[model samples]
Target: MNYRIILALGAFVPAAAIAQDQPAETRDKTSAVISVGVDYEEGSYGTDQDIRSWSVPATVKVQHDRLTFAASVPWRWIEAEGKGTIVTPDGPLGLPLFPSETQVDQRIVREGLGDVTLAAAYALPVKVVNLSVSGTVKLPTADEGLGTGETDYAVGADISKTIGAGITPFAGLTYTMPGSSEGYERKDGVAVNAGVAAQIGKRATGFVAYQDSASTSDGLPDGQRVATGVNVGLGGGVSLGAYGSAGLSAGAPDLATGLRLGFLIP
Candidate 1:
């Protein structure tokens, strides 16, 4: 089977599913708010796999009343030490150091603008709290094979509902397009995203979210991921944040985690 097919399915489906039932709303012109956050993560690529890695992802968001937007760019470096088998036309070939084993010695390093995502959201005035819907597109800025297998673009919608206690639950999905740049084949598919967030007291906030990239294409294995982190409000309108996530299944790699810490001014 071809990896491109897998990449397409794994990348596009879930976004389609989540965006189908969203309601439109008026744009907000309240106050323009800005936030910046950074995260750092480190762990073995998978279960007991010999590969280990770390990353620093930074994100920024701007929001007014009915209108909101966000962007994130992550820089990563990986080092591993494990044996992996690579298949060939003749048969299954086992390379003692195919995957991570030999890479660690040479300090295989991959770093760049992992992926650039841009999103816009509209807020709907509900009774007590508020509800918002959003859409995003992912750009293929990183090397899929050498770095992370990020697709070309995705379109989807998100819903954010707030409760009495400053707690909100958000869910969304997007359609992704795999890059068709020659050897860099990726499955174009739908990806689903969901999460919850809350304000802790007066100076802190926390959130947890998950992304399932399955339906986009059939060429690659299933991609399931989760993320969680916290942010704190500093005096003089400044803030800091950090978060991380790991892949549960999807034999693509052992494990991939991330962390971020940064400051934002309101």
Candidate 2:
């Protein structure tokens, strides 16, 4: 070997070995997503006349590896001239009592901030099937006209199977334990949802789902609903989703529609 080349090689090899002995710290892999949307629902909700409801909701979700956390709240407007109780998308929160024989001239609309909800979920990394478990808490933050003014809790599990080309079948089940209200003691309820989602092209996807929930109180029937929706990617980490639903039973809304816009942050 040439003398100068050997000297250069000797110096370089020790530096390379020293560099291999130390490793840089790994970065934290946490991400967040925010979403806002408006929803409208109409039905009797087991009342004498059709009641229309609307809500504007905002949510923040965070994820780190397989764990996820989220918080959501909504501003609600309810046409409650004939509504007795309201079971929101956040689950049952209100059990308002109105005299059935009250004069129609005395009716008034109810509007305010609805209940605030928090949730956490964890997924297990597995092949063939994906599985996750979650828990949720509902805080009483609304006036008595809009909510039961009580806290509630739920635990749930979700399972999904992914097939070829972005088609997946999924199902979830939740059990809720509700708090009591004056003259109307609530009971635990069970909810289940199943669906198939298909990826259409690169920027859009579609899904159809069925949902059902057991009644949490007397005089209220079981809720059944079917829905279809589409989600489209708008580039730059933004997306939009729209959905429509129909009630399969009297316990659910006769018709409902909603849209959500979401942004992903790294």
Best by TM-score: 2
Reference-based TM-score of each model:
0.60, 0.83
lDDT of 1 by residue, 1-266 (tens): 01111111112123122111122342222323343323233333222334443434455655554555666555544444333421100000000122343423333344444556565665555554344455655555654333333434545555556676867776665555544434334455555667677777887777777776553223335556676666665676554545556666542233333223334334
On a 0 to 100 scale, what is the lDDT of residue 42 in model 1?
38
Clashes of 1: 44
Residues 1-266 of candidate 2: C-alpha lDDT, one tens digit per residue: 00110110110000001000001131136767788888888777564665677888787877776667777778988775443333332334344444344545344477888878787777665555667677777788876577777888877777677678778776777787878766667898888877787878888877777878777777778778887877778999897877888889888888888887879898
Q: Point to the candidate with the largest lDDT.
A: 2
Model 2: which ten-residue window has the lowest total lDDT? 13-22
TM-score of 1: 0.60
After superposing candidate 2 on the true structure, give the runs of residues whose Cα lies further than 4 Å from its correct spot.
1-28, 83-106
Error of 1 at 121 (Å): 3.4
